[model samples]
Every structure is written in structure tokens, then in C-alpha cells.
Target: MPAVSDLTSHIGYLLRMVSNAVSQEFARKVADEGVTVAEWAMLRSLYGGDGIAPSALAGKMGMTKGAISKLAERLLDKGLIERTGNPGDMRGHSLSLSPMGAKKVPVLAGLADENDATFFSVLSGEEQDRLRGLLHMLIDKSGLSTMPVD
Candidate 1:
């Protein structure tokens, strides 16, 4: 193998490291809010849209139905979300944020914005846009439609 240089470490590895760090921080910040990162993701998905079937929500979040079910149960227990029988599909249910859940979504979104600013504000506006473009390109090139939290 050729001698490794600083650049030889590859963008993928660097992106993964940065991603993991940011995710960890977000998880820690949200833990006390009575939701995991996964749950928050689901809540965010349901924030503005009309009710969505659990399976559809799972697909949107790139998670398994089982995982979505578990998170939904937790959200239900916390009174942050509710499940209603789907009128079109008797065997299926749709999820939406309860009034409380709807209320919390914006708060959580604000926190997310704050977190991003805190961590990424060092980058200039152009740099941030460039980074987002590059990351999107990498995702497209890598065929990564979903990211696993685990």
C-alpha cells in the first residue's frame, strides 16, 4: 500500500466521525425532554402533516415498523402523540401529535436550530451551504437514503 497521507483518511470516515459526535450531543440534549433521538425524529415527522400511518412514518424515518411502534407507544404514554384508527384501513392506525405534542414540536425544532448554530456557526454562511451540498452529494453518490442511529 502507498504511504498514507492526511488526505488519505477519506471524507467518508471524517463525515462519520462528525456525524456521530453531533448525534451524540443531540441525544444527550434531548434525553431530559422525555424523548430519544429516534422518538424526536418521529415527532418531527408528524409535526405539521396530517396524520400518517405508522408504516409510512417508519418509512419516512428509515426505521422498522417495530421500532416505530415502540417509539409510538412511548410517545403515547408521554401524551406527546396519539394514534387513531385509519378510516381507510381498519387494521392500520395513523399517528399525529397531540395538542401537547404539537406544542412541543416547535420547541424541539428551536432547540435543534440552536444546537446546529452552536456547533456549526463557526462556518461562514457560504461554507455551511457548501458543506450541506457536499454532504447531500455524498449521500446521493453512496445511495444512503437512511441513516441508522445504532
Candidate 2:
């Protein structure tokens, strides 16, 4: 072989290292609040509206209908979301945040804010902004539009 690049020299490896650390810590923090990151994302998405159809939610979250249905069932069982039948369609329904979920959303959002702050506390403000810009550039260039729920 002429030359082999070191694993540490790969940007993907470096990104994954940091990403895992950030994601794991955030997952633990959210877990304490009785919700996973994916559930939180779904709740947050519903926060902007009164309700949304399952198909619409699946499209918005870039998830399959089956995945959304599973998540919705879990949230419903947990009493964090409510379902209402559509007026025109007897079989159609929409999901919305329950009063409990609506209340928990702000608290969970605070945790997310704190998590970001603590994780990036090592970087200077300017450095953090630059890093975000670079990441956005990469996302935009790659046309990565799917929401990262895992």
C-alpha cells in the first residue's frame, strides 16, 4: 500500500465521536424526564399546532406512517397525547399534545437548552457560532432534510 490514512484523520470519525457524546448525555437527561429524544421531538412538533393527522406528522418528521403510529400509541398510553377524530372522515384522526404534554414540553425544552449549553461550554461563543455555521453548510450542501430522531 502506498499510504493509508489514520482513522483519527477522518472528519466523519471525529464528528461521530462528538455526536455520540452529545446525544448520549442528552438522552440520559431526557430520560430523567420520562421521555426519549424521539418522543420529545414528536411532542415539540405538535406544540405549534392544535393537532395534526398521522400522515401529516409522519411526513413532517420524515418518518414512516407505521413509526409515527407506534410512537403515537406509546405517547397516548403515557397520557402525553390525545387523539381526535376528523370531522369529515369517520376513520381519520389527528393527534395533539395533551395538557400534560403541553406542560412538559417547556420543561423538556429547558433541558435541551441546558444540555446544549453545557456540552458546548468548552467552546467560546464565536467558536460555537462558527461550528454551527459549518455544520449547517454541510447539511445544506448534502441536502439532508430528514429530522434526526434517533
The candidate scoring highest on lDDT is 2
Pick out the ten consecutive residues of candidate 2 with the lowest summed lDDT: 141-150
**Which lDDT tens digits does candidate 2 get at residues 21-126?**
8889989998998999999999999996889999999999989999999999989999999999998999899999999999999999999899889989899999
lDDT of each prediction vs. the true structure? 0.84, 0.94
Off by over 4 Å in 2: none
Give the clash count for each candidate: 0, 0
Q: Quick one: best TM-score, which candidate?
A: 2
Q: Per-residue alpha-carbon lDDT of model 1 for 34-76, expressed as tens digits?
A: 7888778888889888899988887888888998889899999
Native-referenced Cα lDDT, model 2: 0.94
